[model samples]
Target: MNDLSGLLGRVGERKDILLVVLLLAVVFMMVLPLPPLLLDILIAVNITISVVLLMMSVYIGSPLQFSVFPAVLLITTLFRLALSVSTTRMILLQADAGQIVNTFGSFVVGGNLVVGIIIFLIITIVQFLVITKGAERVAEVSARFSLDAMPGKQMSIDGDM
Candidate 1:
């Protein structure tokens, strides 16, 4: 084990580099092709991570215990995006994504094209509306914060008093 340091060089101390490389790999997936086997493995890992995250959130008593939640969430979101892009590219260019995606499509569509299109549209619209609502809330909070931070507004209130 003494030689382990020279080999891997203290991975625990370089977690930031690991995270950045992982994120870069996710971005590279958008441009690179992935084999079906690797895609299946990645899909499995994504599902496992998502389930673990969900379970932790549900069981945890306080936020402090999972202070890295936001970072994990961001990384997972990017990973999912990359997987989606990669899967779509494979499906369009090679006519195959992976067994996991194929099984999921068959299960969701039930071998019916019309029903699948309808379901896809419904899901897309719901996602779009949810994101729009979240963005609206963020904008409202940002505007309110800006207004509250105005020095002239505070000064004017004090002068009136």
Candidate 2:
């Protein structure tokens, strides 16, 4: 009993363990058929985390302040992919995605399929732009760092002779 308690306490302190579990569970979700209720909860959680990440980016003073953004973003992307696959399976096998998706579909469509398609395209474009902008910023920072290090590297080589 004490050993089990110690293992649980260690897990609580180790974020890597949680991340591993999340990745493993996401893989499992792709193969398993999740009930509509669990899918709804995961969808809501993903949206909430995305919103929080957006807020963090908006308020950050520098890119370095959120150095782990890329890893977090990758994890979220995997999560979204897993969710999309799972949702597709549910729709193909059972023809239902859950209440939130149903509500979103109705609200987005509002009786016009054309309008819904247009809205979806616009949203997709906007998402692509946002992701590309972040990628560009990361590239810029990396280039600047490389340039800044060049002088030090040159000096070291010159001194070695």
Candidate 3:
């Protein structure tokens, strides 16, 4: 149990470091040459989702809470599917009209869409599962103690003291 606690402490430290790195990356992007609107939108979306997931990971006290991780995964997959389908439709229409370069651009954009989404979803699920499992282990260890006065029966009073 001590070993497990130490391991969890290490994991928590690593997650804190990663989160700091993520924040630094967001700051770096703010000063880069990229479009400000796009960067802001992406940063806002990522930060909001990260905050919500981090809170969920901390507050939800059981392994079952990890199940919510898949809901986020599923939402991301659906977004990817929508992006893929819409981009495919745009590419096909452009191709039928002989717009070759635009079609190729669309293909390039859509080709990696699903792959990126899959990779991100996998990473997110793994991280959340680690957090949730550690939390569950801690809960299990702490839950072994009981504070009730009686083991199997209530105290009874007799008529005579």
Q: Please give the CA lDDT of all the candidate structures.
A: 0.93, 0.95, 0.57
Give a tens-digit lDDT track for model 2, residues 5-86: 9999999999898999999999999999999999999999989999999999999999999999999999999999999999
Give candidate 3 misplaced runs (Cα > 4 Å).
1-35, 71-161
Each prediction's RMSD to truth: 3.2, 3.4, 16.5
* Model 2: ten consecutive residues of lowest lDDT: 99-108
TM-score of 2: 0.74
Number of the top-ranking candidate, with TM-score as the measure: 1
RMSD of 2: 3.4
- List ranges where model 1 is wrong by over 4 Å: 1-9, 151-161
- TM per model? 0.87, 0.74, 0.24
Clash count, one per candidate: 0, 0, 0
lDDT score, residue 85, model 1?
Answer: 91
The positional error of residue 89 in candidate 2, measured at the CA in angstroms, is 2.9
Model 1: lowest-lDDT 10 consecutive positions: 5-14
